[model samples]
Target: MAKCPEDLLLSGCFSSVALIMIKAPAPMLIAVGMYLPFDTTFAVFVGGMLKLASDKFLIKRNADEKQKTIVENIGILVASGFIAGEALTGVLLAALVLLGIPSITSLLTGQNAFEFTGSAMGGWLSILIFGIVILGLIRIPLGALKNKVQ
Candidate 1:
């Protein structure tokens, strides 16, 4: 027989408590990541890799604690801006959809927009853009550190 939602909820609660008792790190985040879609999780994985790279970059540069803190702060601000911008853009697009404007380009050009989104080239373009964003994530903080020294 399939377990009821109450049973599942209780099981989850017990498991979480067990993990906490075991001194597990980020147990809740790990559990939530397990349930998230692959694309969402993959983005998180990429972010983790970027963070690793940033830490390595700082070590390679022999950054002082103050420099490291400055870079960390800049990185946090950049990440926050990215999150806010994505959320705002999503809200704006949803509003447009609710207003019966399906595609902004189509509204302006009287034709279907984003036809490339279904093609292989579109996939490659997405990868390229993702790479650019990743580079920005690494560079922007380090760049700020450089500017602060002058």
Candidate 2:
């Protein structure tokens, strides 16, 4: 008797469940990374790196419990705001597409001003902007510590 594709899929699902039941997360993380788009995974990787950097900075500064709590709260708030903004932007863009309306950029410029987005210079500019954002993430919380100290 030959096994069907459904049987193979079911076995895969069972194996995944077993992995989870055994408290193993590496396989799950690998599976999710493989399933998600490159940009999505890259964003997650960047976020993880930012978190690591933040932790290291805090340790190097010899932050106390109260200081660490303040920084953590500020970071969480900032991250939440970013997540909300991104979600809202995504919804707005999706609605515009569904309504057959031009994007805000096109409406403002009377054309696609982002045509250069695919260029090498545009990529560099994006990286520079992202680096600025990363710096802000690291500095904003630590800056709060400074204010509290003074």
Best by lDDT: 1
Evaluated at residue 141, the lDDT of candidate 2 is 80
lDDT of candidate 2 over 38-123, digit per residue (tens) = 98888778877887887888899898888888988898788788889889999999998997767677867778777777799889
Span of 10 residues, lowest total lDDT, candidate 1 = 26-35
lDDT of 1 by residue, 1-150 (tens): 966789768878888888899988889767777578888888778887887888899899999999999999999899889889999999989988998987778888988778887799899999998888888888899999999988
CA RMSD (A), model 1 = 2.6
**Top-TM-score structure, candidate number:** 1
What lDDT score is found at residue 54 in candidate 2?
A: 79
User: Which regions of candidate 2 deviate over 4 angstroms?
Assistant: 1-15, 25-31
TM-score of each: 0.87, 0.77
Weakest 10 consecutive residues of candidate 2 by summed lDDT: 25-34
Displacement of residue 79 (Cα, Å) in model 2 is: 1.2
Error of 1 at 128 (Å): 1.2
